[model samples]
Target: MSQTSTAFRGVERLVAGQQTADGAGVRLTRVLTQNLQRRLDPFLMLDAFRNENPDDYIGGFPDHPHRGFETITYMLAGRMRHHDSAGNQGLLGPGGMQWMVAGSGLIHSELPEQESGLMEGFQLWLNLPAADKMMAPNYRDVPSAAIPEYTSASGVHVRVIAGESHGTVGAVQRPVTEPLYLDIHLLAGSRFEQAIPAGHNAFAYVYRGRAEIAGTAVDDRQMAILANDGAAGVVIEAPVDSRLILVAGHPLDEPIAQYGPFVMNTAEQIEQTLRDYRDGKFEAAVVQAL
Candidate 1:
């Protein structure tokens, strides 16, 4: 039997992501923008991209600099090649994930490895705490086979990417943020429930098909921000074959200052980051590959 929660969190509100383009004109939806950073603490941004036309994603993301945050790229289709100034390189294909920490700073590029095909994925920016903002950069490439997955008793297929689900541990875990990232697939009339710490902020993003989250209808491409109403967990039901990502994380409750790709706790830090990049400091920083 699937685990159950006596009290389930409800949807606080629905967000229709803004359509935007970035990284050499690649089109995507900015789901978690700057305005929601504080509301969804520790999670800076979430960009969803899906395209079939080569023209839409041909240019790809050229060299860019980032600092004071970590980026997680989860690919559902196609292939992307990652290269960084610290001599780190990896290829992320369907069902693979790439996690990179731009602790101090780094220059990197993500380019398409295929000429024509469907390119779909999500890039989530997770903020680093002030104390660890200047730590050494780190990178990890988790292939599809590396991610832990299981099927619940109710036929809900789950992929544990960054936290525990049911009894299965995810591929990665962070002590500070304690993020829970689950890719859930539910067949028609299926129900799934997962316990969440009452203190953590949570939300769900429906990527395919539709589902009802805590009695609120969540359609495809919509994000439902779960209320922090002292609920013990969340409950989801699907009327059709639907897939979604459930994400919850402990809030840092710290000030956030961001300038383009750089995020810091203060404006002075942001200024220092600019000078560091201009002095070519990022190129000299060593990257520890995990």
Candidate 2:
């Protein structure tokens, strides 16, 4: 467990609007600032995109390129048709997760099915270590049934996405440092506690209800970053119907070079990623971008 209490910046709220690039979906919310990055390392951005209108979603994400990082998509409401350059294909529905590691390179696209009602999900990016950054690409598609859920002694129901905590191990074995991704739902007047690694950075993203983190009040629709200064495990005294995401991961001390949809080690690498895309060298996945 950590030694200090969690002191996090409250969730940064965003209103997602329609700004179609390669995908037909809209970005409902996003975490994209230095303030947000300080607490969430290894992980870069969090974007929640959804489209209820079939016409709107049919456009989908055309073939695109990615390298140097991983993309995790957790479907909350509808179905998405995914295809990649590696000949990967699937239809992911609610509770399904697609963890794609774009090491040296990979190209893929996701398009919502016409019959699916509301298409909602989150896409998270995780950086790879220098040694593994250029390794072969990989993919893991976890169906909803495969994801394990459990109720803690304290009555906090959790869905494990990756890593482990609260006595439940996320089925997907994460390749990076010890990480914890838990979807925590707490009852009223309940206290939630879990042992986190001593030096990992932790945070809670509240999707509903209200809660208090180390005496700090966090209401619904807010995200709280746990203090990084070697703090003890987190304690949440939450109100009823409180839904939050608890995540903790070891910090990567390497420098970050990010551009658009790719993250790498150096500025030159960022330039190379863009150059590769423009040069058509990374278009092996899905239908290549027009």
Candidate 3:
């Protein structure tokens, strides 16, 4: 039998992300900033971008370097082309996703494939354990149809992106973090529940419409941090049609040192990463990984 959640988690706090521009002046909202890294262990940052104007995202992301972490990009609309130093290339379309692990290091670019129209998506940074920080780099492109999804009897639709949901496994899984990423759509007056492991840290980000968690209203574009108050799981209800992404992961509880795309366990490691990039070592690392 599927374990059910009797005690539901409540909203500890709500976050209204800061407006920020990145990647050649592409505007976006930085949802999970650096301050929350320790609190939301194993997760570094979350950036949400939804732009209709060409000027807002025309430049897209130019050549960039990253190391010691993973980036998960989910596209809701529009197209983006990805090219990396490791000779990995892919086109991410609507409802598609790109999961890139910048283990040792990698230089990559994500530029828009279209001139106009809505371009909505999210980029989540998941931390890597110290043991796997220097492992081989990896990348995977997952199309919309490839993701596992299901609809509950209560009219709640769920797309499992990175972990198991109600026995439906996601497209990708990491043993160390055991991250859970779910995109859920709820009809008016519908309710949904999922049993979350007690030890994992969890939160819900509402992207469309409004929803309720433990009687607290979570409006659109808001993120609700779930309290670890001995709740078995999370219970979400929609008074009206709504969409949200639920993310949970095991806490690494390790030291986090980050310096613009480089995340390491120690400041010395970060300094070494900077020096490596200056010496054009990222390309070599990518070639070695390949």
TM-score per candidate: 0.98, 0.84, 0.97
Cα misplacement distance, residue 68 of candidate 2 (Å): 0.7
Candidate 1 vs candidate 3, TM-score winner: 1
lDDT of 3 at 105: 92
Give the per-residue Cα lDDT of candidate 1 at 111: 98
Which ranges of candidate 3 are over 4 A from the true structure? Answer: 1-3, 287-290
State the lDDT of candidate 3 residue by residue for 1-290, as single tens digits: 24477788999999999999999999999999999998888899999999999999999999999999999999999999999997778999998999889998989999999999999999999999999999888888999999999999887999999998899999999988999999999999999888888878888999999999989999999999999787778989999999999999999999999999999999999999999999999987553321
Q: What lDDT would each prediction earn against the true structure? A: 0.93, 0.71, 0.92
lDDT per residue (tens digit) for residues 64-124 in model 2: 7788888888888888888888777888889899888888787888877657578776777
**Candidate 2: worst-modelled 10 consecutive residues by lDDT:** 8-17
Candidate 2: stretches off by over 4 Å = 1-22, 32-35, 50-58, 285-290
TM-score, structure 1 vs. true: 0.98
Better of 2 and 3 by TM-score: 3
lDDT of 1 by residue, 1-290 (tens): 24578899999999989998999889999999899999999899999999999888888999999999999999999999999998889999999999899999989999999999999999999999999999999999999999999998789999999989888999999878989999999999999999888888899999999999989999999999999888879999999999999999999999999999999999999999999999999888788985
Clashes of 2: 12
Spell out the clash pairs found in candidate 1: none
The candidate with the higher lDDT, 1 or 2, is 1
